[model samples]
Target chain A: MNDYLEIFNLKKVYPSAKGPQTIVQGFNLKLRKGEFVTVIGHSGCGKSTVLMMVAGLSTITDGGIVLAGKELDGPGPDRGIVFQSPSLLPWMTAKENVMLGIEQVFFTAEKEERELIAEYYLTVVGLADSMHKKPGELSQGMRQRVGIARAFALKPKMLLLDEPFGMLDSLTRYELQAVLLELWRKNKITAMMVTHDVDEALYLSDRIVCMTDGPEAGIGDILEVNFPRPRDRKAVMEHPDYYRLRAHLIEFLEVHAHKKKPASTVPAASPAVAVAA
Target chain B: MKETLRKLDFLLLPLLGAAVITGLWYFSSATWAGDLPNPTKTWTESKPYVLDPFGKRGEMDQGILRFTWLSLILVAKGYSIALILGTPIGFFLGLSKTFTKAFDPIIQILRPVSPLAWLPLGMVLFAKVKGVNISEMAALFTIALCSMWPTVLNTAVGVRAIPTDYMNVARVLKLSRWKTLTKVMIPATLPYMFTGFRLSLGIAWLVIVAAEMLTGRPGVGGFLWQQYNALVYEQIILCILTIGLVGFVLDRLMSVVERRFKTA
Candidate 1:
């Protein structure tokens, strides 16, 4: 199948107080229609920067990102983004937050239709009972669920998630992971999620892209997760290959994590050679 | 047992102080002015005023209620007008960084100017209006103008303080301008707006009396000034008390409304 979303030699250089910080260099990605791709790396490996670029929140530096045969421009309803924070409108109820995005996508939708769509998505995210509750009233997990509902209700062609479950507790994280997996399977929407958790990347994604750290970060490796569909958390964890993949990603992370950081002392002339540890 | 005692302890000093002050006032006035009414006499004189401030005594004008109502009306009108104008302006100024920069210096320059300083200008402006007498609108306009700053500043601050992520969510959803204003932005900034409103209203209530003194509007402040000129010491004190009580009640009302709307 033709790649629905393609990144060719994409790079991101952020201008900071000190100098231009190159977040991604020679980074490339190809996404199939309705594919779930998870990218995992240590903190500050440009995982989020990559997602932000794809979502059109940030600009690509060197090359380009194309979606459905068109070059990406700015944020559109066609690409929904869920940040690490809940980012729900605090003044709005869970239902209203979902309706907000739904209305945007279907601008001419009738009031009843909007409400119904909002209700439908809220129920899908298991927030049926708490529809009227605002973000302040709802628990963090519940708020995140509202965020998820709002994103999905828009019915975007692509979903970009940046460390969504990073702040959630272990139990809530696991539960949300299950919900995310279920939604992805049911809808088969193209999703790119950035996570630090190896287990999440292994369980939720069809393929995992591990990113390196910056001044110049790039995709170090891509591992296809050959797990079965409708994966049960316990059963998936008990799979023999699970630990092996987890350890492999961990080793990859460990080696690159330290080497990625600009060394405190002046390094030898060739930084790339020094990175070979 | 200990918690109950601690709570009582919190009330002990203020209560004791109040008692001491009352005792001192009762004794000092009795010693200084032999004809000075004691608390008992003051209470007796005040009974008719309390029961029915409009009840007339022979050759004495019973104008307390009328003055109190007039003062309250001016305060309400001035404060309401300020809220109507200041709220939206503050909200927009708060929402936009450029707008805030454009307007902040003007707001700061105007905010510090005393309301009393504007009274003469207000009287001058309203003096020539065709329909109503200049005196009546002057106090109202002065209170409105003087009390305007707090509401505007607070509303702007509240709007600016809103999390940028929340606005991003609204943008992502492409909420209509009206929905963004009414549903998202206003509700989020309500607590701050109300807090400013409370402060502004208090200022309006405080300033109107003084403004009325200059405008000669039939308010408690004007009445107090009139009674002082006439050497009606009791009436002056009476007007002062009335102003304090009414201001307290207005503040409490705003507080109640604010509490109802405040959410987690």
Candidate 2:
């Protein structure tokens, strides 16, 4: 297969009242077909900003994002993004929300076909019982499940998740991480997840991109998670590499945790040693 | 006992208050001999008028009931017009910031103006409409114009209050503009729009009666004025009671519609 998604020098600079603020710079990554990549960063490392740029929700001030070998334009069906919050439409039932994206993407599909697809995906995400309930009625974890179901229902080539399980309790987050892993495996869909949890990154990703602090933030290091498939959370944590990867990510975050860079470091990628020095 | 009392609370206060007011009116009519007749006499005289205004019962004219019906029709016409026109305008204003910015100031400026101020303009314009006499249309024109503001303002506020995340979902899902407006925006904004509708209905009912009085049209307000001149205190009291009852019913009807939409 092809490189499912390629980000070359992706950057974002937002105009704030104080001055120009750089949110993400020199954000570069490549997702091979069916590969799952998780980006773990401290708060304000621009992890979420990077996801938004890829999703086409936010503009990229410089560089380019290529998805399935085509330069990304505006929002399209090819990229499905689940936000930090579930962000499901409150007025629609959970099933309807999933069906909405499917109907739009697969416009020529008949009504029965659309319903079947929506039902299939909702069951996949473990929301089969919540198909008729509105977002408000669902628990925080359930709502995020609906969001996951909606995103996956579209069958996008690349799934973009911005802290999809961050709001949930520990147990629910674990469950959803497992649910996401299964869905990703079953479909062999490429996904790039932005999260703050180190263990979560190691649990779910093929490669974990550790991000440092920003005004000028980019990947600090990459850890290739070579854990075996159908990964058991209990077994995975016990694996020696899991703790090693977790420790490396924790150390990177602790040193750069919420540190504001001086003006000089706020530009595009300088050498790694430039910041480290 | 506490639960029973809570359930009874909805009906108890209003019914008891109505009875007390009726008792006071009965006593006042029994005591006062001047131009104002007792509540009983007013009711006795007005019963036939309400039931069969056109069918001649006595030599005394049924002009009062006729005027009351005219006012009711005028208010209905005006409020209906307001509902139809204001709802769509409010929906659009609420949905689009561009529309809100362009129209909000104009609505703000016009909304606060007294509906009474529109009376002379209504007379002047209706007089020029040719087929229908200006004098006949004045009450409705004034009522409709006065009632349009609340619906418009309420609708816009509701539209603006839609959660930003909801809008983002609409964008992400690529819902057609038509679908968004119908399935999402309208249903979400219904409560606010109904609030505006109820306010406008009450305002329109009040404004139409007064406008009818001023315009000399056949309605409750005009009938009350005419009855007051005749010095038949009982009939005057009857007309007043009739106007209040009609206005209350009209307000309740609007609220019922609002409630149905709420539950839906």
Residue B126 of model 2 has an lDDT of: 76
CA lDDT, candidate 2, residue A75: 72
Per-residue CA lDDT of candidate 2, range A107-202, in tens? 999999999999998998888888999887999999999999888989898898888877789999999999999998999999999887788988
For candidate 1, write residues A1-277 as lDDT tens digits.
5799998998788788989877778988999998899988766667777887787766667798899889987667788888788888776788877877787788798999889989988899999999999888999999999888888888888888988887789999999999988887888899999887888998898899988766588898999888788899888899888999899898888778667553333232221221121
- The TM-score of predicted model 2 comes to 0.86
TM-score of 1: 0.88
Q: Can you write out model 1's per-residue Cα lDDT over B80-180, one digit (the tens) per residue?
A: 98899889888878878898889888888888888778889887897778998677677767888889888998998899887667666666666678977
Whole-model lDDT, model 2: 0.80
Model 2, stretches more than 4 Å misplaced?
Answer: A258-277, B1-34, B50-72, B95-98, B133-136, B249-264
* Chain B TM-scores across candidates: 0.85, 0.79
Candidate 1: give the clashing pairs.
none
